[model samples]
Target: MEKLIDDEGEIYNSISPKVAPVAVQNEMEPSNISIVTTNGTADNNIGKSKTTISLPSAAKFTNAAQKKAPWLKSLFQDECSAWETTKCGLAELIGTAVLVFLGCMGCVGSMGTPPSSLQVSFAWGIVVMIVAQSIGHISGAHINPAVTVGAVVMGKKSLTGACVYFVAQCLGAILGYGLLKVVTPSDLLLASSTSPAETFCITDLHGKIPVIQGLLGEIIATAVLMFMLCAMWDERNANNTDSGVIKCGLTIAALCMGLGPYTGCSLNPARSLAPAIWNNYWNHHWIFWFGPIGGSLLASVLYRSVFSLPQCSLPECQSLNTQKAELYKMMYGHGDMWDTFLSGMAELVGTGLLIFLGCGGCIGSLGVSPSHLQITLTFGLAVMIVIQCFGHISHAHVNPAITVGSVVLGIKSISEAAVYIIAQILGGILGYGLLKLCTPTGFLSSGGPEAASTFCVTMISPQVSNVQGLMVETMATMVLMLIACAVWDIRNASNTDSTSIRFGLGVTCLATIFGPYTGCSMNPARSFAPAIWNNSWLGHWVYWFGPIAGAAISASLYRIVFGLKTHDKETLTPISESIHLNSVDTDKSEVIINSWIQYRVHLTTRVLTLGKLIRIRAPYTRKKVLNPCDKFSHTIARYKSQNTTFYIPISLRCFSRMNLITDLLMRFEEFQNQVYRVRVSCKHLKHVKQSKHDQRSKAKVHNNISKV
Candidate 1:
């Protein structure tokens, strides 16, 4: 026996080790048996027996799960063993810390003479890109509890892993905030605190928007946030790339800018919780937790059900070259190490630019805050600019939430994610440093840093309550994510080219409408950065929990119901199978027939040559030498040892029509050997009859002579 076995114990190929020619066995049962050849003689030895042989059965092989199911065993371990639990947790920790630090710093400057919403939005957008680039390779840089939960639901992370990451992220956020406190002066820190007077301690929504309205805003915002994340990560979607990161960041910033005045969009629980812990302002904290969690869960369910990758086994889901660069295809299409480095560098530069331009815009306003329109334009336009510049490089994610979303959806590897996040954080720090370098020392001393911090975070108006602020953040972030999803979804052909424009405009719309109520933070990193710098943790939960929840819900809506349908649905049919051949027109029959004849003739020649070789080599055969001329004719077809030729004559065109000759060939195919024999017999019948008559006459004369 010969068997080919794969690394696993499964036998895939089988071949008989040896073959013997012998008589058929009497004991074996046969059904519908055809007699191909037989030899019979009048004299027979009755007592003799023909040779008999038996064939061995094929061998069977099975995996080593005889006593237990393989699926059960797999529960304790992954199908693949390369995943490192500790490394993933560490990445999550580092990534979260980076995001919180930069975002908090942005808020730190916002506390005194706060920059306009436009400036704040732009600054936060840059922060998102910086963190995403710095840490996107490791642990997916979720930096948010809601994003972690969404990852679990998306099947990217195990339940145990999710729990570990959540803890790491929360701790990382705290550590990041602590770093800010260490650097800023105690007096300046007080100015950065998240108080009812200066932070997201909402006491009213311009006296028109109620508490429920604020909550609705958060839900909607967070829904959009999650939806966009899923859309950007959808491989079935063409626009799922680094550019999606920029689009997402820009859109998210716009949401915050627009909704900032209403409820200060705190779309992430970690972002919100860190500052709240530092400041001990726990009022209406439950809203932040519930709103974001609910929204994220909803998004997860929707994305999985509607737009998720077709259900497939783990072994079949791996791609050989997933990291191929889409933006710089000529340089990085092969996905070499150089390409990886270049991608990371792109992220670094892009993130640095995001921070520099965003913060620079705010710091250069010369003391007076710009109007709402100017602020919105500054932020929205900055986002558009970065997207245009770096959209092709690292995708400029700038936001940890989107990175996590990509990982959960399997759009990126964990290692790559870590690199992106690390780069993002460094870029953010550099951007802030640049801002400080460019500003006058006197301005820096006169609440410049504090005001800059204010621009980085979300703060509720005095009239809005904590619950209302949480709701506002959640809804605002959700709406932002939803739009991001739409912009990135390639299925929506009309919006593909104008993604940045659409996203910028959307952010402008959100900021213009909701800037006064909660500050429309719509991002945890943006809100947390300032809170930590100013030591103002009040209502921080609203930023983290709300935005994260919003992201989750948005992922669900766009992936499932809102997203455009793809070109084709997944199916089990083989790629090579012919489905439409039957639908071809009769007019093309000539082409089909001609193609068939060429194929069959080639196959027939090979078969005939093999048979001839076998016969010539047979030792038992007693045959006369064949003449050279007869040999050629015999190779084609033979009847009663007569020289024969079977061919379509080219010179007989006048008598036989081309169509008729082709029709005859077609008939011969259906009837096979019988048709050929009949045709030959008909052509030579007269000659054969005459020759037989002469032989009979001669035999009669010879018999009479012998009798005489």
Candidate 2:
């Protein structure tokens, strides 16, 4: 129902029925235009502006008719039967059993008469690695039933299969544990620590860490872990590109290791339950089960609501949606024009969040410094959590002026600079507003050196002078930015996710090194959020001015000075830049970005040869420009024919067949991923004819596309 673009001459995302022929739009466009095939666009979405369109469903074929067209079902059935074969299922079951055994074995070993943190931690993680590798082919080896449950709750899996998976996992865990009990030596059991879980029960009975704190810990940890899972599983996440068993394995393993000490890492109830049962650590079982499960449920709802994008309503799932309205479009900060606006807004909001959580959190109104150790750990952890919360959305810039400075320094844009700054300032005050709603005056009391009693207040003293603090802040920002750019390049527009956890820990490490000096305002936004919130805006400029100047100077210094900008002109990493717009401006106002190409297409399809680049407009019925060496053959397969090459998902209807300039386009991201894309050919079209169920969408996917 949006603007219908005539690329060359193909209908990109309109309602095109299989048998009900429709007239294709052909005039008022320029010679720069060319038609690309719509042949079963892999996705119903045509362009980045995918709009939802309702079309009449295909008429169901009768038995007689189906018999006449035997190819319909027969051709679509699995050939070698990969991904869902019985062999895959068996491999999954065995893999699940192995994971349970090893994870339990590690616990048993760690809790043995002589407990070892590293050994136990590694053991639990190793199970994830081993099993992920073993059954990853058949099933994404989700060994723990709870994780499967989490996945289903998160909508990554179906309820029916998740239920079956849980049952299988429970049975496997029981068997693995039972076997261990039989094989274990009594001496080791006697020596083990009665499970460090006793801390939850010790409960200074009331004052120190009330039952609420323990519950909160479990909730927070579980939620963070679940969020990480979503990012890692995202096919779009550069970290998850062509996701194999290894990436998934490392993801779980890293989570277990990093978060193990907190709430005993009960992100998975199965991991906790099996060990707790054998160890008799059931007193706080509710904290582990209810808390984590509750958190998981909340995280699922939030993620799906806020981040899980909806499929386009376009006839096909096209990347360049024909709809110009904002409702159906997802705008990123790095994207052009409107995208840049959204990106700036995101920066503002994200930075505001950063300031509120990191700085506000640092000075929890506890005028006293707990043993230096506690201050170092508690504050550092708070920063880690905040980073995880907002990293993906705005690159969690949480700082307005860093990019502004980058822009001024020629690394970013100055035209829309005000937007980001305003967003950042507002987000800071907003965080302060929310902070007031919580925090009892008592919790604000002198707990440690960083506490500010005004509840919303941001000012406080420091161990060092402002200059000393400024230097430290600048140094810290330099480190964080480098790591940030490395992990997330705006040009690449991708986040390292949990893969580059060392970068995440880097913040904590900085806090440990510089917490005493000016409270180490590595991020200007971090410093500003609390200042605006607490009404203690005095000396606010120091936090804002100091960190901003430092970040800008450092971002340019390292990125430009050292040639780190190879990723993007902006020192910022690309959490959204993973997608590049390789556009072709047909002067007719049509632009087409090959979503599947190694690089991005910036031209809107309306400006290019519609979605098809092969055929010209009706007035210009020029001969085809096929390559002398079968270039036309490949371009057809890559662009129109959806048999084997990478193409954009146009829609359910358009995917079946396409006619356009089918050609192969290739490029690579900083990580060296070779993206091979091309148009479909007649031979490829033949393959699509034989396939069924979202044929166009399947062809557009970037994975192992069949032979063109």
Backbone clash count for every predicted candidate, in the order shown:
144, 137
Q: In order, what lDDT does every prediction score?
A: 0.49, 0.45
Q: What is the TM-score of each candidate against the true structure?
A: 0.41, 0.54
Clashes of 1: 144
Task: Name the weakest run of 10 consecutive residues (lDDT summed) in model 2.
Answer: 662-671
For candidate 1, what is the TM-score?
A: 0.41
Estimate, for each residue in 1-708, the C-alpha lDDT of model 1 and write its tens digit.
Answer: 233334633222222323321122111212211111112111111123221111111111111112223332433443323467677777777777777676666655435664445665566667776666666766666777887777666666666777777898889888887787788764565423443422432212223335665565455456546655655555434444555556656655755654444455677777777777877777566656766677777777776664343432221121201221221122112234554565566555555545444443343234334465756554555456445534544455655555544444344578877777666556655644544543443332222334544554557778999888878877777787776666555567455545566666766677677777776756454445445544677677877777777776776666667644432211222211011211222122111111111011100111123113101011011123322323432332221122333332111111111122222222223223321212111112334457678899899999999999
lDDT of 1: 0.49
Positional deviation of residue 48's Cα in model 1 after best superposition, in angstroms: 48
Score candidate 2 by lDDT. Answer: 0.45
